[model samples]
Each structure stands twice: as C-alpha cells, then as structure tokens.
Target: EEPWTLFTDGSSCVDGSGAGLILINPDGVEFTYALRLQFAASNNEAEYEALIVGLRIATQMGVKNIQANVDSKLVANQVLGTYVSKEDNMIKYVEIANGLVSGFKTFSISQVPRSKNKKADALSKIASTSFAHLSKQVLVEVLETKSITGKEVTAARKIRLKARQYEVMEGVLYKRSFLTPWLRCVGPLQAEYVMKEIHEGSCSMHAGPRSLSGRAGESQVPDRRNGLLHEMDRSKSGGNDYRRTSEEICMGQYCMPLWYSKRNNLGQRTMVKSSHGDTPFSLTYGTEAVIPAEIGMPTYRTTAVDVVNNDKELRLNLDLLEERRELAAINEARSKSKMTKYYNSRVRGVAFQPGNFVHRSNDANHAAAGGKLGPKWEGPYEVTDALGNGACKLRSMDETILSRTWNVANLKRCYL
Candidate 1:
C-alpha cells in the first residue's frame, strides 16, 4: 500500500506561539491543521508538539503507513534514535513521539530544509499571529490535553472558570453576560483598539467606562430600528443648521464654489436642506420665509396675512415648532450615519497605544528652516500617554514628557 505523507512545522512570535501540520493521504487528498499553543512555549518544544499532534491525527485517520517530514534537525534525529535528547523535557517529548509512531504498521521520518516545508510554516504563522477578528470558517477547538501531565490546559481551564463567562459558537469565541447578549472576544492587542474606537468614534460620548461598554455592546445588534425610534424620542438638536447648505447653494449658482465677491449667501440661508428637512431661514425665524417669487405673485400665505392674523399664526407655529425640531434632529443623525458609513468603507483604521513611537507633523521648526520645501513630519517621539479623543502625550528620546498632548491626526507611527 502507498504510504501517507505528513509535513510539520512550528512558529513562535510576540503575538502567540503555535504549530502546523500537513497530511496527504496515498490518494493525495490533503488536510492542513494549525495548533494555537496558548501556553508560552519555546520553538523547539513547538516543533515536537507539531509532530506529535500530526502523528495523533494520522493514527485517528487509520493510516496504516505514513512517512513524516520535519524541518527541525534536533527533533528528527532524536526520534530516529541517533542524537540523544539531553534535557528532561526533550526526552519526554521523544518518548511521547515514539509511542505515537509505533501505532502505524509502517512509518519513517526525516529532516528537511525549512524552505521545503513552506506550506506547514505558512499555516503555523496563522496560529502564531493574533487576529483582530476571527471568521466562522476557522475551526477552533480547546484541544484538551492527551494526558493528565498537560498542566497548561488544566491551568487555562481554571483561569477561565474564574471569569465565569465565555462560549464558543461556530468556532468563534464570545464573552457571556447575565443581563446582556454575548460580546465577541478580542485579543489583548485588539482590545486596546476597541477601547480607542469606543472613546474616539463619532457615536461615542466622553462618558465613563460603563457608558462606553453599553454602547459598544449595542453596536453589534442585528436590528437598529428599535434604537432609531429611541433616538428620535430623545434627540432635541433639530438639525437647525445644515452644514452643506452653503456648498449646495454655491454649486447650484456656479460650477465651482468661487468666492462670490458680490453675491451674498442668501440663497444658502433660505434654501431647504435634506439633513434638516427645512430651510435655515425657517428654522431660525420659526416660520416659512416669504420667497421672492411668492412676494412678486403673492401666494395664499402672503395674501391671507394681516397684522392681527400674523401674530396669532406665528405664535401657533412657534408652539408646535418643538415637535418638528425633534424629528429634524433624528433625520440629521441618520444622514450623518450614512456619511460615516461611506467614509469608513474607504478608510482603514489604525490603532496606537502608549509607548508607541510616532513622528509629529513639523510646525514652525521645519517650515522656517526650509520654507516651502520643509519636512512635513519630524521627531520619533514616544507616546507616553494615550489621552482620550484621539490625543496623546509624547516624550523625546531623553524621556521627559512633552508639555502638551498631540492629536493622532498629526502623527504617523515611527517604526524601526
């Protein structure tokens, strides 16, 4: 019978440590697996772990014959009964590997150059890197230890129990809560980004952590209709002044927004805007403006007006104006939401944290030195503090804190 082939590799990084393996049956059907080693593990241990895991998978698949390839010379020689494992842990790993290999009717393992084992290496990188988000396609498992000697898994279980919350659905992990729906779990690195977004995002108020948490959780809900209704009831701003009014007026009057040297912006002030759903003049005056055309011809509103009638009608309009303002505010918020969504689709977000090195926009120092050709950014300053609202405190190489916090918009990360 043709022998199955297995390739194994391991990777370790600041983000995480993990192993990977590739299995190809005699018929050439391939299977790839990535093992996320949650426990802190050295590269050599990871190598052995990958081989052991691959062996177990092969055994379970009922493969009678298998040939394994590994990139690590030490692991390959030790398993082959050539170079002896001097360390206690290495010796145990060798013993465990031998036990798994014995199950196959025929088996052979050899050391191959790392380049030859690229597929396994690539898969290993997936587990070694911390992801901002995981899709349902990734198959995640707890991988309870093969034996009681697996202290890492046991310790992790204890730590999870203390948190008293969490669940895995469709291979994606989420945090459980008694009063609220599950919150998707974020990696330590991604958690910092989540906090920053909640603090500086458009919908956020500079409220305390409780408010931030509540809002962040609600953002994931499937339906926003209920929230929109609540927002309409609570909103009061009334979109009294639509910012695009001047732009729209200028565009309609002239092709470009030329600084109309002679023309006053009366058109902008009187025109209706979609966001506010009313004219600026109407909002400010609390009554429909008498347009020039209407004044020329005299519409019903203008014809019917008298001094005694005008005062009573204006007062009535003023009385019902509050309700209109609330609806306008809700419309303004919805319009802003659409704009924000479009803006975000084109922009990729960047996250910065304390201790990150960044270059600040050069002000007078570089401008005066080089005039028009001056450098745009300067200084590899260290981020000493990430103040809320996209602001940060920086320090120079000497380690003294700068006098003020800088906006992140004017900074770019300085990578070595």
Candidate 2:
C-alpha cells in the first residue's frame, strides 16, 4: 500500500490562548481534533502540539507510512536542519518532533504556503474557538477504481501542493523563499511566507504613503501626511505597531564587492585565484543587478588575469589586508567588465557634466557616515565639465549642489 499524507495546522489566541489541531487523511478520513495546551504558549508551541497529537492518532490507526505537511516554514526548515530555531519554547517542540520522526519507520515533514493549505488552515481556525468533541473519527473512501480487464495498474509518486512558495516533489520540499510584500499590507504573517526570485532582496511590496526619509526621490509625502498620520490612524484602529516601511540595503567594499555592466549581454565575470590550465571559477559581487534572464551579463577579468599570472591554483586571501588587495583585484575586473559591456550602447558609457541631475548612491548616508555603504556606485549627477580622463564634474538638479569630480565607473545613467 502507498503511504498516505496527513495535513495538519494549529491556531492559538495568545501565548496561553486556546489551541487546536486539524488533520486530513487522503484515503478519505477527515479528523478535527482540539486540545488546550496548559500555560501560555507561542504559535510554534501550538503548531508542535497539533502535530504531536495528530501523529499519536495516526500511530494508533496502525498507519505505518506518512508525509506530514505544515504551513510553518520555520518549523519545517528547523526539522530539515536548514535553519535553527532560537526560541526556547520552539526548541522543545523541535525535540519532540524529532523523536516522533525517529520512531516512525517512514515519515517526512514538508512546508507549504498558506494559500495551498486552505483546508488545514480552516480546520485550525475552527478548532481555535469550538469545543465540540466529535467522539468518533470520520472515514469516507474518497476514491476507488480498477479495470475489470486483466490490465495492470500503476501509481506514480504523489506530488502534494504545500504552499504558495513551496511544493512537495516525491516527498521532498523545494522551498522558494522569496515573497513580494505589499506596502499597505504590513503586519506579521500568521504563517510563513516564501520569497521568490522576482522580488529577490526587496522588502516592501508596494510604495508606502509616507516619504520615510529626506531623500525626496519620488513620493506624494505631503498628500499622504507622511508616516505620522498613518501611524496615528493605525493606532486608533487598534494596531499599535504600525510604522515605516521595511528597508533592505547591501553594503561593503572589498568586504563586499559590487557588480555592474549587466545592461549589455556580454556575459558574467568572476575574480578568483587561478591555477593555470584549470576550470575557471567566478566570484559573486555583492552589488549585483537583479536582471531578467537571457540578458547579456558581463564576464570578469579573472579568466584573463589567471592566463597572465600562470597561477595554476586558486586560493582565497585570508589575511584582512591581503583579502583587501585580492578584493581590489576583483573590483577592477568587475569595473572593466561594466565599462566594456556598456561602451557602445545607446545609453553609452556613464558620463557626468556640470548641472546634471543625480541621486546620491542609495547608501550615501551610510557610506559617508560610516554606517556601512550600500551599493557603492552612485550618480546620475550632471556633468559639470569633462576632466580629460575618465572623470567629470557633477551637480545636483534641485539644489544645484556641486559634487566632487567622479570616475566613469562611479556613474550610472538616470532611469525612471
């Protein structure tokens, strides 16, 4: 007989609030179970409790093989050893879940997004409030069919839908952890949300009403009354934690390099030590453009440098100073790639002349204030004057503020 899948979920009001568990068996048995855990507990604790109780019921039913689907990515990942659970209450649940896994001859846990887990999610919500005890387990044969002819029947490996960002393929979870967060839709998720490649590193889904900072980039700040009015309205509506939009910025120099010149499709570049006549490898830059696939990305100077050095083996520089030098080498390779990649484009090589409008690097404050520089390359600054070399003077559009002359590598063309 093939293994059956049990989908379970839990819900609770507070740390010590009401809790319940719901499980469904694919073979047509539907079970609604509830238990109020003593003492205040977290959502994770309730989730763990639900699973334990459901597992106990399955074991009693003589089920020998099972796949457990859950909506808690953190718990799922923790069980799979991909992430560590740091909470004290969660640790206990983790240990219990592990023990149950060891005891079951065939058992696996998988993560699913909440959208794909509607039934279990609904059951959990129902369990949270109702105290009705369905004394007997409900069983209904969902499907049964066979050909009368002496024909052979085969069943393929089952693939269960886990969540919006995950799926169970042959009982293994393929978790895609990227989510597009909406600006106005801010709050803690009852269940984990998976982030995807498109959204990548950005945190906010939609533009926030408030102009959170002084940058004055693009916004309707005055009309939105900034974040202050939004916060007050949210508070009056019973939400006290509403605040500014979530921001994510990447920074670092040799410690974390940047990548550019991806606008043109030359190919990707990498910097690394080279042992002559070996498979070439490329190191990733920290500031990389999240471009669509099939676009020509630039290649690094590592391949060229390795050929020149006749170095047969690649080794990462460990000493801080040595690493800094190695990083500089990689940065140079990246810069050359970017410049060469964009040399002939309609956009042309980045050039700044006097009176050009430009936005400072996103991390201007951080880098200038020693707060950790975000994307090192900055500008759109107008060229005040051509400086003979690969440099030009710049100025802000609004303030007419003059900026120090910058190298071509430091400028990026303005884009809306």
Candidate 3:
C-alpha cells in the first residue's frame, strides 16, 4: 500500500495569519485545504496548528500509513528528536504531534526547503506578503472546482414576492423605486443608519462622544517604576564596569557620577590598548597622566619638574606626537590586514560572469527586522558589468541597472 503524502505550510503576516495544506493519497488525487486562522498565532504556531489539523483530517479519512512534509526545520527536527524543544509552546507542539503520530501504524515526517515545496508555500501565503521588497507581489491559488455553479432559476411562485421589484444591473442589485428610477436595495438597519446620518446633518452623529475616563488614563504620567529597565545581560568590556561603578559611587546618598567619571576616564585613557600597543593618553596629550600618589611621593619626573625644563620637554613631545600617531596608525592597519588575510584564506571565493543571476546578502536589508524569520539573501539580480577589480554592476529583475556597484564578496551566485 502506498503511503499518503501530506504537504503543509504556514503564513503569518501583518494583515492576517493562514495555514495551507495539501494531501495526496495512493489514488493520486490531491486534496488541498486553505484555512484562515481566527485566533492570533505566530508562524511556528501556525505550522504546528496546520500539522495537527492535517493529521486529524488524515485520521478521519482512515489513512493508516502516511508521510507528512513541512517546510519548518524547527518543527521537523523537534518531531524527529534531533532538536530539543526549549520553549513551552514548542514543547507542547512536539508532544501533541507525537501523540498524533502514534495513532498511525506507519507515520513519518521530514523537512523540505521552501523552494521544493512550492504548492503548499503558494497556498500558505496571505493576500499581501513578499520574500523581498517589491512594488507588486503575486500569490497563486489553484482550485479544482468552481465555487458558484448553477443555472438561473425561473419564477415559480404565484404569490407577489419582494424579489419582483429587485433586479441585477451591472452586477449591482437595485430595487424599482417609484421616487427614483432605480433605488439600491439595502438591509433595513443600514438603510435606517444612512437615512439618519443624512437627515441629522452629522453633528456628532457619526463620531461618538469622547469619554473623560479614557483621556484620564492618558492625562496621568505612566508609572516609571513599573517600566524600570532590568539589567539582564553582562558585557565583557571593562568600560561597562567603569560606567556602573561611576553610577554607584555616592556622597551622602547623592550620587556624584560626574566626579567619578573623571577618574574613570583618566584611568581608561592611560590603559594600554592592544590595537596600537600604546596608551590613548600618551597618544593624545604627548605624555602619560601622572598619578597624585606619584606627585606626593616625589617620583623622578616630579623632582625634575623645573619650569624651563618642563616647557622644553612639552615642546619636544608635541613635535614628535605626529610621528607617534603615524606609527600607531601603521600598527592598526597591519593588524587589520593580518585578520583580513586569514579570513580570506579560509573563505572559498565565488566569481560571477555577465548575465549571471545572484543574491546579495540580506544582512543590511533585514538588520532592522532582526528576527529569525525571512530570507537571508535578497535577490535574483542579474550581473550586467564586471571590472577586473572585485567591483561589479547589477541589474534588477525589471531590467533597470542599479547606480551603485557592489564588491564581489557581497554577491552570491544563484545555483539554479
């Protein structure tokens, strides 16, 4: 016996959430299901919802052996026990799915990429959603049967009916009115509302009164205590510690952060940076910051602080400051070059030719939308021009050439 195949995909968007599923039996007939979820759900939740519904349908149809396919790697892995479900919702979803799988004698589920599962993916998308930014997006839905299929009915009733006055003109239902040539028939409640609005001349008839209770909440300032930020993450940098310490230091319960920040900043400036192997204070002021303890203890530098000698030393340091900074810049550049060379060595290079279609990394495009969802790569842009250098020009799907050229590193070729 051939195992029935089921494909499911879930869509969550700004407008609405929906789930679409298609089931194929041994007889090779496809039964497609499109569902509009009444309740609010995330994409993952909708995926599980669709799967559960599909499994329930297959069970009702008395299908024993079945193989389910879903595009969600999370759902597929969790069901297969390859991934552990940490979230409460996902854990519950896995449990529910496992229970359903136990009902069938031979049941298996596997994950497929979105491209391979086009039919379910098409059905899963709602009215307005796009993988990339686009002016016009198309969503395809195929159905085997027409929704309305019947011939027009002949008048059979002998009694005077309300339908006699109604007629369809340009697909608009109109009633034969005595006062007017054709009056559009409407529900009694809507007709009453429209007549009232017209008669009353709208004076607060349309927009209702604004209650003070609603505005009273807005008038009061929100409780800052309730919205207090929690320090959840700890940074590895010492600068964060300096900032926190500056905030904590107080004089008689009054925090003198500004005074504390001066010391912290001086300490930070004197601290040796790994990049240039030198202190920022020395690089800026042409001399290291002398500690108060060093002055009190009479160090060699403090003892040598003659007015004439100090002036000459300061002038000499200032003259050599430019040379010191030039060395620092060279060191920083060398370090960066070493890192870049190492990175490039490990990376396998990808080259594009003319007429080649590629996807630019969607990092910048989707950085604001930093969620796990959405495509990581943005286009199927065509390569128009390529220079000997790593720079290239691209053309969009509309055949419009982009003004800005991109580095070859950012361009990834489309496999298909």
Candidate 4:
C-alpha cells in the first residue's frame, strides 16, 4: 500500500495566525484543514503548531507508514533530530510534536521547497485572513492555546492610547500643529482621494507613488486608454469645425461619385478571374451589364438580336449556376486552409491539461494606483476544465471558479 502524505504550512500576518494541513491518503483522496489560532504566536510557533496538529489528525485517522512535507526548514530539521530546539517555547513545541510522532508505527518528516507546497501555503494565508468554516470534506479548527502550554489559560489586558497632541472630534482625529490651528488626520477614504488627485488630476503632475513624498508604490501599472482617447480628440478638432458648414453638402456629392467609381472598379477586378470565368451580372441574368460606353458606341454583341438562340443559351447558363457556386466554395476553403497554416506557423502553440497551475494576465483587473511596478499576472489558478482549442476554465486558490474561460494566449504556466 502507498504511504499517506501530509503537507503542512503556517502563516502569521497582522490579521491573524493560521495553520494549514493537507493529508493525502494511500488511495489519493485528500483532506484539507485550515486552523486559526485565537492566541498570539510567532511565525515559527505557527509552523510548529501546524505540524503538531497535522500529526494528531493523522494519528486519529489511524494512518501508518506516513511521510510528511513541510516548507519550514527549521521545523523539519528540529523534528528530524538534525537541529536542536534551544528556545523554551521551541523546546516545548518539539516535545509535543515528538509525543504525537510516537503514535505512528512509521513516520518521516522532510522539508520541501515553497513552490511544491503552494496549496498548503495558500490555505494558511486564507485561514489567517478569514474564518474558514468546516465542511463535509474539509475541516477548520480554532486553537486557543499555544502547543507548549496546551491547557494554559491566558489573561487579557486593555491598553490605553497616549496621543497628547491629537484630539478625537466626531470619531475623527485632529492633530495640533505649531504652524496651523489644527490639522485633520486623513482616513483611508480621504487618503485615496488625495492620492488620486496627485496621480491623475488635470493640474497635478502625473507622477507615480515612488515619486510621491512618503507614499508606498503600488504594483500595478497605469492604463494608457485615456491618453489614446485624448489624442483622438485632438485629431478630430479640425474635422469637427468643418462638419457644421454648407460645404458638407458639396463634399457629400463629390464623395458619392468617387464611391461609385471605386465600387465599379472592384466589381470589374473580381470578375476577371471568377470561379467560372463569368461576371456576377452575367451569372445572374445570363447577360453582361451594359456600360455607358457600350450604349454611346454600339458594340457588335450589343447590336445583335438573335432572340431564339439567346433564350436557349440563357437556359444553359442558369442550369450551371449551382456548379459555379460549388466551385467557388471549394476555392474559398482552399484559401482559408492556407491562411490557417500561415497563422499557425507564426504563433507558438500552448496547451494546458486540467489540474495545471497558471497565471492570468492582469490587464483587466488593475488597481487605481497600480503604477508600472504592479503585478502583471493576477493568479496561480488551477485549470479545472480544458475546453479544447486553447480555452480553459480556471479556479482560484480560494476555490472560487472564474465565470469566463480564458484563452491560452492570456495564460502562462506558474512554476510556484
């Protein structure tokens, strides 16, 4: 039987601390867990907690001969006896982990690269950002205590803010400055307005965040569609003035003859080597359209009046119309084949199988201040369904399926 595999990762951000575990059974079925820590912990502490919890889960499932993968080299080395846990907290965590490890008949811990452990990493980030609820196939748990003191209860303390120079007025803070009477502290909404004005306002210099004083730069680039529209408006200014004049009537009449002459020239060119060597007018009525020159100066065929034989020839041409149309269809297909071959030769072909991870272009989903340094791709979405001809449906790391399928040209494989 194949050995069970466990992948674990941890995340500690300002939002919260979280642990993620993915257990794959011998049958290849998976069970995912997103654990949120209610208590305070460092990133290393979170990683250790994730490993301990995952071991406990595997023990409960009666798993034997298991192999565990973790992205944290510190945790993996400590657990494997390669590194010593010197800190008090780490020592306690290591003991708890070893105690859990003793439950399995055979077990091994190995450190893997972050790229290979992305699913677990994503889950840990999600747990840190949001409260993930447990479902039938998935489990989410809250740990109130650190692994070192599993049963210890911690007391909460309330701290008072010391802002002597700032006063709260109607839920808004105002700072007292020597130069000014009082300066209103800007909230996120006000800050956003200020940034927008600085970046894109008519009077303001169109500068990036890196150029702005004390402002952090965004990862997305600015769109150039507005600049294109402004250029188009400038080009149409002279034409706009001419549109409101009596000269427009004269121009319209002058353009009609030119248009008609162009159309007649195109029709004559098309008839020169048509599928059946016959002009469209001749094919329709079994007689060519008479030109003005032919009417002014009579031609031999135009003057001829052989009505009896003409009727018989007209019947024969009418009967051959279907054959001529079929031949035209064949020629059109051959032309399209050549075009398709040429197009394929110039463009590289990319095919993605279902379950592959890929990053999509971020052109349609840029943030307001996402200057030139902004991320060019948005996701490492999984290919859930491959709709042939270079189209595929994608699902995000969070399990949210995108509404539209993306073309392969707009997608690139993600290594991590």
Instruction: Identify the candidate with maximal TM-score.
Output: 4
101-150: candidate 3 lDDT, tens digit per residue: 99999999999989888888776684225433323434558998765554
lDDT of 4 at 40: 87
lDDT value, candidate 2, whole model: 0.49
Worst ten in a row by lDDT for model 1: 252-261
Model 1 Cα lDDT, one tens digit per residue, 61-147: 898999999999999999999998899999999999999988999999999998999999988888788543545357668976575
Query: Candidate 1 — which residues are off by over 4 angstroms?
Result: 136-416
| Pairs with backbone N, CA or C atoms under 3 Å apart (clashes), candidate 4 | 219-373, 219-374, 220-370, 220-374, 221-371
* Per-candidate clashes, comma-separated: 0, 34, 0, 5
By lDDT, highest first, what's the ranking? 1, 4, 3, 2
lDDT of 1 at 389: 78
Error of 3 at 335 (Å): 50
Of the pair 1 and 3, which is ahead by TM-score?
Answer: 1
RMSD of 2: 32.2
lDDT by residue (301-416, candidate 2, tens digit) is 22124554333333332224345556667767877777776775545446555555545554433334433543654544566677866676666655464646666565566654
* Superior by TM-score: candidate 1 or candidate 4: 4
Give all candidates' CA lDDT scores: 0.69, 0.49, 0.66, 0.67
TM-score of each: 0.33, 0.30, 0.32, 0.34
